[model samples]
Target chain A: MPKKADNSGSAGSEETLLDAAGVKRAMDHLCREIAGALPGDCPVAIIGLRSRGDELAARLIERLAEGGRGDLLHGTLDITLYRDDVSKRMIQPQVRATVIDFDLDDACVVLVDDVLHTGRTIRAAMDALMDYGRPAAVRLAVLVDRGGREMPICPDFVGKTLKLSPSDSRRVYLDLAETDGADRVYLK
Target chain B: MADKTTTTAVRRRSGRSSGFVWGRKHLLGLEDLEPAELLHVLDTAAGFKSVSTRSIKKVPALRGKVVVNLFFEDSTRTRTSFTLSAQRLSADVIDFTGKSSSVNKGETLVDTARNIEAMGVDIMVLRHAAAGAPHLLARKVGCSVVNAGDGAHEHPTQGLLDLFTIREIKKKVEGLTVAIVGDIAHSRVARSNIFALRKLGARIILVGPRTLVPDQMRQLGAEISHDLDAVLPACDVVNMLRIQFERLQSAAFPSVEEYSRLFGLHAERLRLARPDLLVLHPGPINRGLELDSAVADGPHSGILRQVTNGLAVRMAVLYLVHQAALAVNGK
Candidate 1:
């Protein structure tokens, strides 16, 4: 659960936006929304961006299996080499393994991620995915959509819409039990 | 040299969680790199290894960046590896050999490199007959410089590919006894391997004849051995550096027959080695002289994998140097 986050060293600098129970509810709703919107007869691939997005994809796959849709092709994409800001950054980004084993031909691939902010990541993810194979259609699913999109892109499904202003100094972070110690969303 | 001071990066690991960032605009040699820097390149190479497996087999990491292969000497393998690596990373590559370039018309090496850099080249992969040509060019040019190979000094990517192959197969580099057999006195590959492997915590045994294997190599933290048979039993990995006859001015050993009998790794000598000994050769193999065709093609051989890993390692090096150059320019 989001247990009174105080790790930011101030009394009210960090707040637990969503608890564990709330995260579970949002995930269930997201799965239902995605299942209802997905085409019935087409092959679907659940692809995740690496670091946090891939873990969120795995959880999505598990939830889809629970709902009896267990036949989705899944993979993880590492877009380190596709970033536009690589030369602008001081440190070289560590490249992770991209493990898309299945063919992407004529399949509807859903790109999943934890947070959607600047939209450049989705653009990079799309570029990386296309290099693998030509999918019939590509959709996007994000858990949190704090809208500050620099690119003209939109997510097909979103778990939470915090609507945080793009220019605001505050930030939102997702802590999954797989990577972090708990399942919660915190605002800092 | 002014280039030495400008390009010599501080050899300390960064305190970042994922590890230190590569800060050098040029990859001159591995001799000055810290252990963490070596592992960082290896780890980055591990990530790039998958790009070759994909159907597309390309990444846009170096898109819009230009890499010029500036060679003052003749080479087939290293030049092609760098060329393909730059292509695979989506960088535009220009190949310049000494015969076709203006250097044959008495243009100085620095002038040639500076003229190329003026043509929008972002990085220069240099191979020269002089010992420190890349360092000299790095001092003269504004673009990043990568030493492909320099006279008896170092071939850093070859060293990195060997380290990558060993780590991929043996799963670790520390505590392994690596016997680098043949031509330690003149092999740039051997020198680079010793510098890189020593930094990565591997015990090195430089194996060759007493004439070819210099006692001065021991100062580099390697055990000097004249007998390959004795070194084979304890070595977990054996890298057969090509006997560089072109680099030899006088008779280093008596004859090819005597040298092969004493140091050549064949089935007969392979039997004396550990059953799981990993074999490596940095290409242009001297078929029967350095290793038998069977041993070079045998199950214990990682020679082909070394070539494959060479592409990834070169990609990592190019990507890193380009990133450093951009950072240095505040781009």
Candidate 2:
């Protein structure tokens, strides 16, 4: 998932990278890839990062259920309190509730997010998830993976790999119908 | 400060906007907080309410932060609630009391705070017998300051927890009449609650003998009443403040027994109130005086829940102030 505001500004040249149909195809492909990788009949905890990430996770759960994996656990992780750069930001992100009702112990946890850029959010999410309980395995899934990594972390599942400028001045946004009222991927 | 401007620009450029930005490094009182700010603290506390129920019961939000409890006044619940709240957020807590500390030797409050901050303390929760003690320290110290209680001034966290408990039990604060009964003039809790509840659109009735709750308190936008039973029927919530014998300069009332008979919330008085009237007490209660044992422990009581919510409110305050301080200092 791209770091939010990684290249924040008026889109230098705003363009739609993926429309609704393209988003659907990417999601379907990503779902199949995730289903094929997980062990059959294993109860996977489909946890999403807060804000748009949780929206994506909910959609992912519904998609997985349609594929006959109805035993997946749903959870939402709020990484606002876990971010390493809390003091560096001007406006403090609203700290929302992290609703993980089911036990994470020995369960397969799939962490979901919309964009992966600096990998800091995923780092924070992992730290937060570990506080609840240790899982049998934890995997990362994202809708968009734009280049530029500050941490040595990689995602196990990715919907689209976008190649933007290495200068980090371009923004990547994945808007879903659940949150933004439209499914579209755009570059700014 | 320069970093904030640049980062704020960056944040705006990123196309993400948060409606509220907590800008204060210290929470001295509820008197100055806007309605939205009051709701922000309550909402944040609501988010933290679930953290205490977890198996680990700890979060790394303040993992490396240090919080000092500097109490110039005696308190068991507020002090312990703050300590536990800091610990639950994984912050290192140092408890400094007025009796055992250098303040006993006539060391000024500023000197004590500066010395503690020199040791890299991130936040200081202060309780003093003097009003504006925390405010004075807030000006002198670079670290964040939280007012646990100050003489007849405001216990912001206590006010917040009361609001939290009210909102929890009643599902809202607006359009509800809350009667804050007993020791209003000498009660920092009553002062804080009046500011908070009034800001959130809840009508307030300050009930006590005229001596303890003066007529001048009406300027704070609360109806003053000497009759508890008269006010009880209209109140959706009743907060019973402890009768501070230590704070009284002279006899404000005739006697404890007389005051109990007139204003005490026993079974008889309780029956006069609404069936679902939420009862709250900032504890170390004069058990039979302000509240009876039955009512304090009864079904309508949010007394225990207030204590539980106290921790969450304090945690939210500490975490917010620490973040504000860090954002300002960029450390």
Candidate 3:
């Protein structure tokens, strides 16, 4: 079946990309997909891939709580040290803290990132997460799936799927009302 | 004449980048170091280790340079060692205790570092309660930053001295089993030791309370154990970390008595270790909690050697950093 168009309504017309109702619907669908993949009520965790992913994870938690699963462990991951390209980069990278509140042993983890592109960021996130604790299983989730995967990686739950030309780019601008106030994304 | 020849010789000796040419920047963590660079630091430290034994005990390597010791956390051993090391290298030292500084009067860390930088300080040795504080300050200030100890993050120089002490005793770091015992979670020393020891080819075993030894340690290639006895006999070097009572306010362990019974390295347990096993502690050792005094003062203990080597290691760091800065500036 073809994926549905994001008639989630026009994004720019709403003053911000995602409105409260649109965010709730997207989160609800995401939680359902995540719930279906996870084993029966085993203490699952949501490890957001820093910055925006962290905010998305918090929203997912709230959505899960409203749906009667309030026990999901939440954490944020910083993958600066684990990035393979750190040494080659000219600018000094910014490093944020990795905060995992619960032990990862035997826990199912939903690794969330804002977008899925080259898959390198997710790969770095995985490496960083391993430095904390070993999880039983880790499933990937993303708000937007803009295809350009250099590696074999697929998000289990995706909010929107957009195909872009090799030279062009698709950016997700999340605002404070929904995600965070930071207007960050890719350029062509 | 003789003085001109001596000056040329001194210039050649100082100018030639031996194994000691680290980058012209602050060393906040070993994570930023390459294997060659790490080895360079150690080899240079070995040279300084010899210089520490001389009667005059001073070098002009860092002459006319200014180093500031800005300690936000109270420490006698780390501060004093750095101060003496800077002075021995002929660098002017400015010592600032956090309690007496404007930090007590609500001055921010960056402001304090900037103030010190404005004084024409070339290096700032900082110890703070926040992890990555030195790294933050190092980016803002013009001077090079040397982390004394940041909150459960890293004490790079301590780690360097520990490695130096181990290499001195064991001859080589490869194929040795090293057990770091006690408060692993709250120890910047443990964090740095893990990096340095692992890089130099020592297998690490982290023995502590379940709360103190995070489950994630295994990912760092360390074997984690709650039972000290299980790891003692196999270790070639037993590094006892200080038990921080301050962190205990969070109830990381059940009780001090219980901790002593479970984790403390008494003389009996020390005997259980390999006969050639060396004991090490980043001191201010707790008498009965993490270690027994008898075992600490025992023949196998290298506690005092760590202190002595600390000065030499720091001297080597100052010397190398100064040289690297000079090289970068084309001086």
Off by over 4 Å in 1: A1-15, A38-40, A89-91, B1-19
Per-residue CA lDDT of model 1 for B7-88, tens digit only, reads: 1221111111254667889999999999999998998898899899889989999888899999989999999999999999
Query: How many Å off is the CA of B277 in candidate 2?
Result: 1.5
- RMSD, each candidate, Å? 5.6, 2.8, 22.4
> Regarding TM-score, does 2 or 3 come out ahead?
2
Better of 1 and 3 by DockQ: 1
Query: Taking chain A of candidate 2, what TM-score results?
Result: 0.90
Poorest stretch of ten by lDDT in candidate 1 chain B: B7-16
Ranked by lDDT, the better of candidates 2 and 3 is: 2
Instruction: Give the Å error, residue B118, model 2.
Output: 2.1
Task: Give a tens-digit lDDT track for model 3, residues A1-188.
Answer: 12323442332222234455665556667778876666665789988876568888887888777777778899887654345543332212333346776788888999998767889889878865665667888899987677878778888898766556554322343433443333333321
List, for all models, the DockQ compared with the true complex: 0.33, 0.46, 0.01
What value does the lDDT take at residue A55 in candidate 2? 86
For candidate 1, state the interface root-mean-square deviation in angstroms to 1 decimal. 10.4
| Per-residue C-alpha lDDT of model 2 across residues B1-331, encoded as one tens digit per residue | 3344545654543333355778789999999999999988888887887788877788888998899999988889899999999999999999999999998789999999999899999999999989999999999998999999888899999999999999989999999999998999888899999999999999999999989988999999999989887889999999998898888999999999999999899988888888899999988889998889999899989999999999889989998898788768866
lDDT of 3 by residue, B256-310 (tens): 8998888898988776888898999999998878889898888899999999999
Model 3 TM-score, 2 decimals: 0.60
Deviation of model 1 at A93, angstroms: 1.7
Candidate 2 accuracy as lDDT: 0.87
TM-score of chain B of each: 0.94, 0.95, 0.93
